[model samples]
Target: MNKTILLTGVVFGLLAVVFGAFGAHGLEKMVEPEAISTFEIGVRYQMYHALFLLFIGLWTGLKANKKRIVYTLIVLGIALFSFSIYGLALNSIIKFDFRSIAFLTPIGGVFLIFGWFFTGYFILTQKRIN
Candidate 1:
């Protein structure tokens, strides 16, 4: 599970960099300034979560099950939140209307908030050795 989390973090981080580059370069010519900003937001959040996952993977304070819960929430959050933003930002170029799924961005944000809250709660409650 730790390995999985770590690998996921690496993948997310790599993709974030790639997406960030695209947003900075290729995306500028294709999308409006506002759309580029939105795409940048998605990249920023993806990078943040990637780092979060990397930290979670290395931390030994949490049990496997607890880590799994955080992992699931974060993964789902990224999929729904960042990816949706990407789709919406690219709506001008893509065939589908990303606005149709705009509701998911907030939903995914909720998941991310819960994941962080749970992590803090679990850590605060954990018994520390003297």
Candidate 2:
């Protein structure tokens, strides 16, 4: 699970960079200003959580097996939040429809919040090095 999370984190991080570049260069002229802003928001969140996943991966390497599920939730939350924004931005850009999924983004945010909460709980519960 750790390896899977780490590998997925790496992939997501790389893809976020690609999408950011695509937004900057490929989408600059093709998308409206508002859509571009929306896409940038997606990219920002994606990059943030991708780094979170990377940190989870590092923690997994040093922690107990119980931590893997929390990391996976973090990754899943990132995917849901980032992809929904990307899809919505694209839909707006192309004049397609996808309002139904917008509500899911908050749910993803909830997952992300809980993932971090669990991480903090684990850290606090661990035996102190002192």
Candidate 3:
């Protein structure tokens, strides 16, 4: 599970960088400033969650089950939140209407919030810190 979390973190982090670069260069001329800004937000959140997963992978404070919960929530959050934003940002150029699924962004955000909350709750409730 730890290995899975670590690998996921690395993958997400790598993609964040790739996406960030694309947003800065390739997307600058293709999209409006507001779209670029929105895309950047997605990249930022993806990177943040990637680091969160990396830390969760290395930290021994949380049990396997707790780690799994966080992992699931975060993965889902990233998929729905960041990916949806990407689509929405590109909607102007793309044939598909990303606004159709715009509701997913906030739903994903809720999952991310829950993941963070659970992490803190689990750690706080633990009998030992170390």
lDDT of 3: 0.97
**Can you give the TM-score per candidate against the true fold?**
0.97, 0.86, 0.98
Give the per-residue lDDT of model 1 (tens digit) for 25-122.
Answer: 99878989999999999999999999999999999889999999999999999999999999999999999999999999999998999899999988
What TM-score would candidate 3 get against the native? 0.98
Clashing pairs counted in every model: 0, 0, 0
TM-score order, best first, reads: 3, 1, 2
- What is the lDDT of every predicted structure here? 0.95, 0.78, 0.97
lDDT of 1: 0.95
lDDT tens digits by residue: candidate 3, 86-128 = 9999999999999999999999999999999999999889999
Lowest summed-lDDT stretch of 10 residues in model 3?
Answer: 121-130
Instruction: Tell me the deviation in Å of residue 86 in model 3.
Output: 0.5
Q: What is the RMSD of candidate 1?
A: 1.2
Query: Which one is best on lDDT?
Result: 3
TM-score of 2: 0.86
Task: Show model 3 residue runs off by greater than 4 Å.
Answer: none
